[model samples]
Target: LLGRVDDVMLVSGHNISTTEVESALVSHPAVAEAAVVGAADQTTGQAIVAFVILRGTATESEDLVADLRNHVGATLGPIAKPKRIMAVAELPKTR
Candidate 1:
């Protein structure tokens, strides 16, 4: 039986912490902040996706975005890496 502490899955397998992705993003100078989500994926059981808002005059460039994704791979290994990242203007805070 599962207890209150039952684990959750995000992308690569089961029982992943959101902090891994968070730590990856916060390491970048271009990123102001980021929010991650575990969306359903038909192929992998789950998919890790990220929404980012840029910092001080940073343009929304693809290379920087790619670097951020690669940074995740470096920080948390390929398993904890995000499959997709979207740069957003603002976050949906209360929903």
Candidate 2:
């Protein structure tokens, strides 16, 4: 995504910082870890989505999602807010 940034987003517009998303997800108390992806979106043109693994006893909640969204917005501004966030048991790994 560094060299082929333009090839990454097949949709219109670009304002999100992929690196920042990576950082923000890790910053969440509920998120033990995360991986960020670019999802095709009609509205944002290219929506950022986060697939996260939460810490022990931390379940996915609407409040967590909203808080994370707001955190990202406050730190990186609205452009960096993810369109969707999915809390998975674990992120798919590359063997």
Candidate 3:
């Protein structure tokens, strides 16, 4: 049997799940894939950082990032919203 603990991040005393943040990101029409991680933050303890693979119609720009951040905020909540969003060509894969 194989098992492990759920990867949960603490932000301002709140439990934020990376999977939840990633799901919120992909829900945006412009996003193809997303990976969410926790970054050390002086105020929040940890902040949500997202790396996104955008759709063909999407471009990496300030407006797009703001839109994505707003999308996540609407989908989830302000707390679940990504503090930083980066568009990436691809995410590393392992077989």
lDDT of each: 0.77, 0.76, 0.87
Model 3: lDDT to the true structure: 0.87
**Tens-place lDDT digits, model 3, residues 1-95:** 44234457898898988888889899889999999888999999998899999998789999999999998888878888888999999998758
Assess candidate 1 and give its TM-score to the true structure. 0.79
Off by over 4 Å in 2: 1-12
lDDT of 1 by residue, 1-95 (tens): 54333134555455666655766797888888888877888988888888989888887777887898888888878787778888889877766
Candidate with better TM-score, 1 vs 2:
2
Ranking by lDDT: 3, 1, 2
Task: Indicate whether candidate 1 or candidate 3 has the larger TM-score.
Answer: 3
Model 1 clash count equals 0
Q: Candidate 1 — which residues are off by over 4 angstroms? A: 1-8
Question: Which structure is stronger by lDDT: 1 or 2?
Answer: 1
- lDDT per residue for candidate 2 within 1-95, as digits (tens), equals 25446324422465565667768878877778888878778776678888888888988899988988888888877777887888888777779
Count of residue pairs whose backbone atoms collide, per candidate? 0, 0, 0
- Which residue pairs clash in candidate 3? none
* Clash pairs (backbone) in predicted model 2: none
